[model samples]
Target: MPELPEVETVCNAIRKSIKTNKIKEFVIINPKLRWNIDANIKKLLSKVDIRKIYRRGKYIIFNFNHGSLIIHLGMTGIVKFLKNRHKVNKHDHYEIKFQDNTILRYNDVRKFGSIHWAENIEDNFLIKNLGVEPLSDNFNYEYIKKISKKRNVVIKNIIMDQRIVVGIGNIYASEALYMSKIKPNKNCKLLSTDNFKSLVKSIKKVLQKSIKAGGTSIKDFQSIDGSPGYFKQKLLIYGLEKCACGKNIKNIRISGRSSFYCSNCQK
Candidate 1:
């Protein structure tokens, strides 16, 4: 699945070309995705001018004159802007035609991505519960400390929880834990203030680096321009089971998700 950095990259690329463009039409290739397309969406967005594009967690918000269009790029989903009409692929779920004749295509192999019309993005259920953005001022060490006190979950799971800190997915979580030199299996309550501070810094550093590198291209992720991210080349321990420490890194399952860490370095 595309995480925050990948989503933000798409948002930026789309914003440059699509902002202020009038929506000429919308085509829903898959009927399952048009649950309320006609009644709720068409009435709200047809011919509306796109105001701006922003991201909340992994979702992209296409702001318009009346309501905003919220897009979640679930696993195996990609949104691209095409200069001309082309043959639709098997998973092309939605398309938005712009007044300039340029079309934005949404393709999802898993059909898990969604598009919804929202009057106020902040009040929407999906956007309401998301935790603070890692890049925002609200996501400091103190904030992490406050949330860490709520449960005895592993630090890895605690950071992965969207309710505690949004956008820290499995890949980034492993990288951050490794950077902080904290064991991925450490309980949240076992983290001291120093640990929280180091973890918070590592989270920000890892995420910023990934964004700069255009996000990790693991599996099906690609930028709007169909370019694969290069961050994977810089990974320290996420997929390196026989890491450089001469001691093997352990790959364990926690909360049913795979976690990677150097047993020698991350204790």
Candidate 2:
């Protein structure tokens, strides 16, 4: 699945080329995605000028004259711009043709991505309950300590919760915990103030580095320009189960998700 950094990278690329353009036509090739892809999008979006494009967590928000378009790049989804001679491929589910003949194509092999039209996008249920962005001032160490005081769940799971903090996915969560030297299975309530501060810093550092590198491309992730991310090379111990650490870096299952951490360094 595309994480926050990957989604932000795509949003930035698309904003430059598609902003201020008018939507000439909109097409949905996959029916399963049509449910999330608003049926009245064509009617509401026709001729509406795209004013800006931004990202909130993992969703891309395209600001328009009367409304906004929210897009989620689920698993194996990529959005790319096609100039002339734009041809739709097998997984190209959604396309928005601009008056300038530029094409914004949304391709998702898993058919789990979404494109929705919202009159009041910020108030929409899809975005209303999201927690603070990891890079924002709202996610500081003091904020995390307050939230952690009442939670007894594992620190890894707490950070992974979208309600607690947005965009800390499994990979980044594991990476951040390892960097903070906190055991993934440690209870959130037991975390010291120092640990909380370090975790917050690690989350921001790791996410900032990943965004700069255009996100980590573990499986099927690409920027809006169809470029693969380069951050995977900097991973410390997310997938290296056999790395020779003084203590084992065991792979454990937490909340039905795979977690990787060095037993010696973390805890």
Candidate 3:
């Protein structure tokens, strides 16, 4: 599944093509998704002008006056902009034809992605409960401390929780914990203010680096140009057999997600 950085990359890639463009048509190849698409969505979006494109968590928002279109690239999904007459992949389940003849397509092999129409994006069911953006001012050490109170889960799980901090997925949690020299399985209750402060910094740094590197592409993640993310090459601990400290990196499952850390380095 595409995480925050990947989603942001998509937003950046699609922005120019989508913003201020008039949708000539909404082509629906398959309406079956994780959340079924409304049959009339195509008709509803016809001729709608796109004013902006952005991301909230893993969901992409295509904004216009009085309405917004939300999309989630659940897993194995990618959106691409192609020339008007380009070859279409079989997984191309949704499409938008701009009045200028630019083609935007959403393809998902697993069909787990979704599309939604919302009159108010902030109040949409999917957007309402999402936690603060990891890159925002709201995700400081104080906020982490406030949310960690009485929470017994592992530190990795805590940060990965969308309700606590949005978009720090499994990959980032492992990298951040490793960077901060903290164990991924460390209990949230066992962490001190200093520990939380380190974690907050580490998370922000790791995420920013990944975003700059165009997001980590272990599998099924690519930019709108079909280019795989280059961040995986810079990954420190994830998927590695040994750490820089020359110790074997531990691979443990916390909350059913694999976590990588060097026991010799991370506490």
Candidate 4:
């Protein structure tokens, strides 16, 4: 699945290239995605000007005069811009054609990706209860420390919770915990203020680094340009057997997601 960084990359790319551009065509080759797309979406978006494009969590929102178009790139989904002459791939399920013939196409091996039209994004159920963005002012160490007292779950689970903080996917969560020298399985009650401070900084650092590298391309993730992200080469603990501290890494599942840490390095 595309995480925060990947989604942000797509938003930035789309915003830069297509903002204020006029859409001449909107096609849904597969309305049977994660949810059925509105039958009138094509008519609603045709000839509409894209006011802006942005990301909220993993969903991409395209702002227009009438409303917003929300998109989610579920597991194995990718969106790319293609020329009119390029043959549409077998997985291309949705597309938008600009007046200039530029195509913004969505492809997914699994039909789990979705596109929804909404008058306002806040009313969208998918993002209604989402937590603060880790890079935003609301996700400071003080906020985390306060929340920590009320939650008894594993520290990793708290950080990864979409209700507590949005966009801290498993890969970045593990990397941030490892960077903060906190074991993934540590209880929230066991964390100190200093630990929370380190966590906030590490989370921002890792996420920013990943976005700068265009996001980690573990499986199907790729930039809007179809370029693979370079951050995976810099992964420290996730999916690794050895740590930089010359210690064997430990693997455990937290909330059914793999959590990697070096017992000798993380405390």
Candidate 5:
């Protein structure tokens, strides 16, 4: 699934290509998504001007004058901008034809993605309850300490919880824990203030680096231009079985998600 960095990359890519453009037409190749495409989505979005594009958590928001369009690239989804007419594939489920002949196409092999219409983005059900953005000032050492103190689950699971912190998916959770030298399965409550500080810093550092690298392309993820992310080449522990510290990297299941860390390095 595309996480925060992937979603952010999509938003930036699409914004640069389609900002200030008018939507001449909206086409839905199929309405069957994770949630059925809203019936009024076409009526609300077609012929409107795309004012801006932004991201919240893993969802992309396309802002217009009167309303907004929200899209989630659930699992095997990619959004691409085309300059000319091309062969449409079976998975190309949604599209927006711009006035300048540029096309924005949404293709998902699994059909797990969704497109929603919202009059006000903040009040939408999907955007309202999401926790603080990991890269924002709102997420800091003190906040992580307070949230982790109340959870008995492993630190990995605690950070991965969307309500406590948004956008730390499986890949990032493992990478952050490795960077912090904290065992993924260690109880959150057992972590000291210093440990929480290190964890918070690691989370931010890992996220920022991945975003700069255009996110990790383990599988199926690609930039809007159909290029694979280069961050995977810089991974320290996510898919490796050994560590630079002369220790084997352990792989375990925390809340049913794979976690990687070095036993000798992490406490």
Candidate 6:
């Protein structure tokens, strides 16, 4: 699935190109997605100007004159731009054609992605309950410490929770834990204030680095330009069986997601 960095990459890649474009039409090749695309969405967005493109959590938000379009690129989704005359492929489920003869297409092989309309993003159900962005000022060490002190779950699971902190996916969770020298499965209550401080710093550092590298292309993630992300080459231990410390990296499942860590390097 596309995480925060990947989502942000998509948002940034298409923002300048799509902004101020006049929407000529909206097409739903299929309405069967993780959430069904509303039938009235085409009429709602007809001929509106695209004000902006932004990201909140893993969802891409397309701002318009009267409302917003929220898109979740579930597991195998990629949003890209193409010519208005471009041929539609098998997985191209949604599209918006601009009067400039360009098209913004959303393709998802797994059909887990979704498109929804919101009068105001702040009042939308999907946007209302999201936690703080990892790169924002609100996610500093002090804030992380406060949230960590209240959780008894494994620190890995704690950070992965969308409600606790948004956008730390499985790969990032492992890398950040390894960077902080904190074991993935360690109970959150066992971590001291200093540990939380390090963890917060590691989280921010790893996320920033990943975003800079264009995000990790583990499976199906890709930029809007049909290019894969480069961060996978810099992974520390997410898919490795051995660590640089000459000790075997451990693989464990927490909350049914694979977590990698060096038993020696991490506590």
Query: What does the lDDT read for residue 112 in candidate 1?
Result: 77
Off by over 4 Å in 2: 242-246
Cα lDDT computed for each candidate against the true fold:
0.84, 0.84, 0.87, 0.88, 0.87, 0.88
Worst 10 residues of 5 by lDDT: 12-21
TM-scores for all predictions: 0.94, 0.94, 0.96, 0.95, 0.96, 0.96
| For model 2, the run of ten residues with the poorest summed lDDT | 30-39
Q: What would the per-residue lDDT of candidate 2 be over residues 1-267, giving only the tens digit for each residue? A: 777888888888887777447788887766466256666877877776778888888889988878888988877788888886966688888788888888888888887888888889878888889999999989988888898898788999889888878888888998999999999999999999999999999999999999999999988888876678898998887887653465667899998989998878888
The regions of model 4 sitting more than 4 angstroms off are: none
lDDT of 2: 0.84
lDDT of 1 by residue, 1-267 (tens): 787788877788788767447888787776455242444575566677877778888889988877788888877779888877598889788788888878999888887777887788878877889999999889999998887888888999988988778888888899999999999999888898999999999999988998898888888998888998889999888888677778898999998988999888987
Taking the tens digit of each residue's C-alpha lDDT, what string does model 4 give over 63-106? 89899999988887888887778776787888999998988899
* Candidate 1: 10-residue stretch with minimal lDDT: 31-40
Higher lDDT: candidate 3 or 4? 4
- Model 2 residue 153 CA deviation (Å) reads 1.1
Give the per-residue lDDT of model 6 (tens digit) for 104-191: 8999999988899999889998889889998888988788778778778999988888887888888899999999999999998889
Residue-level lDDT tens digits of model 5 in 1-267: 787888888888887777447888888878888998877777776788878788888889888999889999988889998876777888888888888878899999999999998889889998888899999989998998898888778898888888788888889898898899899999999999899889999999988898899989998999899988778988999998789887888888877778898989999
TM-score of model 5 vs. true structure: 0.96
